[model samples]
Target chain A: MTYVSPPPEARSRGWYKRNEIAVTPFLFLIPAVLFFAIYVIIPIGQSFWISFHEWDGLGDKTWVGTANYERLLFDDRKFTTSFWNNIKWLVLYLLAIPGGLFIALFLNQTVTGIRLYKSLFFFPFVISQVVVGLVFSWFYLPREGLLNAILAVFGAGPVNILGDPSTATYGIIAAGLWPQTAYCMILYLTGLNAVDPEQVEAARLDGAKGWRMLWYVILPQLRPATFIAFVVTIIGALRSFDLISVMTNGGPFGSTRVLSFYMFEESLSEFGFRMGYGAAIAVVLFFIMLGFIVYFLWSMWRDEKGAR
Target chain B: MQSIFKASVAALALGAVAAPAFAESHTLSGDLRIISDMSNPAPRAVMEGLAADFGAMHPELNVELTIVDREAWKTQIRNALGANPPDVVNWYAANRMAPYVSAGLFEDITDMYENGDLTGLDSVKGALTIDGRQWGVPYTYYQWGVYYREDIFNELGLTEPTTFDEEIANCQVILDSGRKCYTIGTKFLWTAGGWFDYMNMRTNGFDFHMQLARGEVEWTDPRVRETFANWRKLIDMGAFIDDHQSYSWQEALNFMIDGEAAAYLMGNFAVAPLREAGLSDDQIDFYQFPMIADVPQGEDAPTDTFHIPSGAENKEAARAFLQFVTSPDVQTEINSGDGLGQLPVNANSGVDADEFLEQGFEMLTTNAEGGVAQFFDRDFPAEMASVGMEGLQEFMVFPDNLDDILERLEDARQRIYE
Candidate 1:
């Protein structure tokens, strides 16, 4: 390919032409960048802007700067309940990662119909969260549920898991964990397949086995899978709206509200749209997520730099 | 389907509105586009029939009807009303319409009431009014009351009580018989609000209840506390089903159906379901939520309405459509047992001959002496209602938390109304 740059007109736009190799990637990125800016970044800015005003979604915006936040931070009991429930969700949801790893290790071995076993273990993840919520809600039904039937078989009394405010959030988290654990198990299973067997054999030869081997040799090799799992699990815990919506609609007296569900309840729910207050809630959620995001990015950067 | 049919019919039969529907003598032209949320098969059919009938009447006019999913229409309503709205759309009455009314998204149809054709609309004028002006007109509503298992009452040798003392005595007897007196699901919170509505209205009268709904009264007001105390009487009696907070209102029906719960303090909608569940007409019956106080009885009846958006291009035709809907004949046809299965807003409209409808219609039109509330969630502002219902549910569960719950609701009422 001969470069035809003899045209004087082309020279005037020479910078781009000369740097086309470097600039072409950015030019190619234009569409994705524009989409992200419009759908993601702009909306985020809009949310922040809305957080400063009192808007009923349709009516004129009344600038009541910081009032929403002040009420949320100090006066709102429901907000306090939602924030604490989110904490419960985050802390409990991490159990899925460890739970997934255990199941992954147990299932990684050769067995009769191992493929069937693997898929069976992964089945929960395949179902939609809404389905999971519905199934769990039915299971928690005091009289007509399989859970109570099983409890009866054991001569134990029925427990209304979803009815009691004290236990409702935990019940939903447990339901959420069912599918999340499956998701993490799949991640770990793939990670295990990529494990260096020679390295594992060497570690075994040195008397490393069970928990010791899992902690030092096997885990170190599974860093990328673990990282991805951690990221998804954290985000899943934060944005745990569907299961809450389907399972409880943040009810049994709203004992199961997390930030995401509460935001929907305030902003776009049939109740009424307090878009500004919802945005303020969203803003708080964003900051919380931003903290974890910055940490994850920093860790990824550190890893990349070390590799370099 | 049978339950909705029966429930709505019973509700209509019980309605007391006696407004005379005047025929529209004027003719209208141009496109009358209507987007209705009557997406349920039965209501959808009724809405289509109304549109078709009206279109047939106005041969020179084009009637375009769009039936949207009831749930989906909720979020889309604002956007639809904001930009290029249809000529008329389906919406709920009361505070549900308040936001649209204040924003002027809805047409100020106060002048429509001045039209003699809509003279019958005066009775339900409150439901569709905001800021001392009418914004729309109600098409249908159903009565809320106790639908008890007459079989259970018969088995227990009991009768429907008419006063608070008798109510307690009957509940005690029902409880002693190893059955719950009431089967309520507070899972969604609104069911508890219904209980609160009856208790509060019965205890404090309808006007006081409305004042509380309007946030004119504080939650911690002694009168409000008295309402709670009255509700606590039933809660403490364990009258409601066990573990009710877990069940939806639909799911709670199992107890009533199975005879484990003696009654349901519900809208007339429960009648159809009771009949479907194999209860004979004699096995189930309607009653005013047995009067709890000396005050006049008030009832909760959430009215579904139709409105013309201000952005409508065919205001003249839309106005005609509104008039047509509120007219007595259309109201009777639409509210018939096979149509919407509910009461026509027009008091002059004759209801179906269904037993529950006869009782419900009689109750609402006559026995509902104090006032007709648009249910708790409807009458109260949305945010306040949401918070209030939650507090009410909490109170039902933990009666000792009354102080805390009242304080919290008082806070919400202050913030919400302000």
Candidate 2:
């Protein structure tokens, strides 16, 4: 049947006009927009405003421009230590990306009940951070804990893993990696599923095996998964608080104190509610996070532009 | 389409009807939220029972309770007190309450005192009173003392040490027996400070501690130095647990219970855990730390009280709850628990009334009679406590820098006062 095309204005008036279809997506997104505005956008703005003032959570707030920041920069030892430790955490925590890929490749076989083994490996990640901290702390207990018990069997002297300042932060970080590596492994496993079988067979035919296969063929295919794993690991390391709280409470002379725990300690702890000072610490932390976030976003943007 | 729209409208109407019913109850509407600093399950059970009783009595007031950890509790109380404090909640005594009271954060229960709603508040009245007006009602108070395992003492055939020399001898005996003399944890680090407080209280008395708290005396004063010297003597005699940096209060208790350690220099709160371990009252005993020959006596007890926040929603209800808590009946119930054998603030309530509280009462009352000092943290401002705790931790970890440590503390004190 021959049909005449309607004019633009008439099409706009029609039910399934371009304008109607275009507006439909935004209509469906109203609830999400409202939620994001209420919970995320507003709070970030409020926190930034509060960062500039000297206000306890309750009483009258006094405007003190840049004083909190000054204290955070020059006065607060806890803040400095925590920030430096966060740097260490970020650097060390990214090790999980490669480690996860290694484990995923090892366990990605189509053997019988390999699924059960994968789930079991992922079990630590499934448990709460609080439980992981508790389990690790008990494991590291010097006198009667599982670690000490194991050491005793070997006739080795007991190590106070959590108590010793040298090992405490690293010990907690190791516990964090237990779940983090599992998470990365799951991401890689999904990425591995979409790998080109024909290319793998061709590579095998060309005598590319093991390390050569992984470096030239497999890892390149898992680029998206690796990036996600690295991003999450970095964020997890920077924001580690629960395990430290549960395990050490920044004890043994505040040696294990991190930015998040230190911020909490400074603001609302028995040390006194120096809320302004706390905000300054938070601002420093936010900037540090912003730096990482900006780099990641810039890289993504560059990749998108290059693709176009 | 019409039928679906009608059903949707009916469902929306029903949801609107149900929303108000969720909040509107025959039972009390708002939860009578009580934020306690006591997070341990031992006291939690007692508080829960008390809450249940309180709820049953006043059906209109629903009591929802939470026990915040100590550090969080302090911060939360500070935050809550300024704008929207709990109607009633726990607070520390004396110097600790001064800042809150000065800020007008706590409600004055002066009426309770005048009307005789609080009968024996006059006795421990100094505890909750800020600026000569009552800000809180005392719930529990306990003396700081050496909590020794009577079993260990019996095993070594040694008696409780009454004098400084004898205390050293007791440590000597324990060391001779191949067991450590004391069980302590410097991991959380405050347990070490308890020793310093008690020693300072015994060596220097209340006036000296008050001076220290006020930033009047140098932290490097000879009196403070002498207290450290005494602590060093115990250290020299090998009177403390090995690897003390590895444990918390409960972990230290485990050492004492297991017979790896002889004594735990702690407050009466230690009794509850010992009791929980099935150790009878006779298995554990308390004694004041030995006196330095020249130092005047000072009280070394800590007191916990309830203060009304400045912006309490239910002022009358909060006041009534505070008054009720300090009443003899409720105080007696608190003392009945092994975890809270803290002396009752109401002196007239008498120790003989509650079998459990009698021992703690005798200790606190005796210290009060002898002119003892307040516990260290209670006597000092929060700023000072922070520095003092750090100093104590440093002293334990590095005993040789006694002079340097004192100087550092003095610097901290100067900074805080400034």
Second chain TM-score per prediction?
Answer: 0.92, 0.85
Tens-digit lDDT track for model 1 on B11-30?
54543222222223556788
Instruction: For each candidate in the order shown, give its overall lDDT on alpha carbons.
Output: 0.87, 0.76
Q: Which candidate has the highest lDDT of all?
A: 1
Candidate 2 chain B: worst-modelled 10 consecutive residues by lDDT: B16-25
- Cα-based lDDT at residue B364, candidate 2: 59
Q: Which stretches of candidate 1 lie over 4 Å from their true place?
A: A1-15, B1-27
Error of 2 at B270 (Å): 1.6
Model 2's CAPRI class is acceptable
Best by TM-score: 1
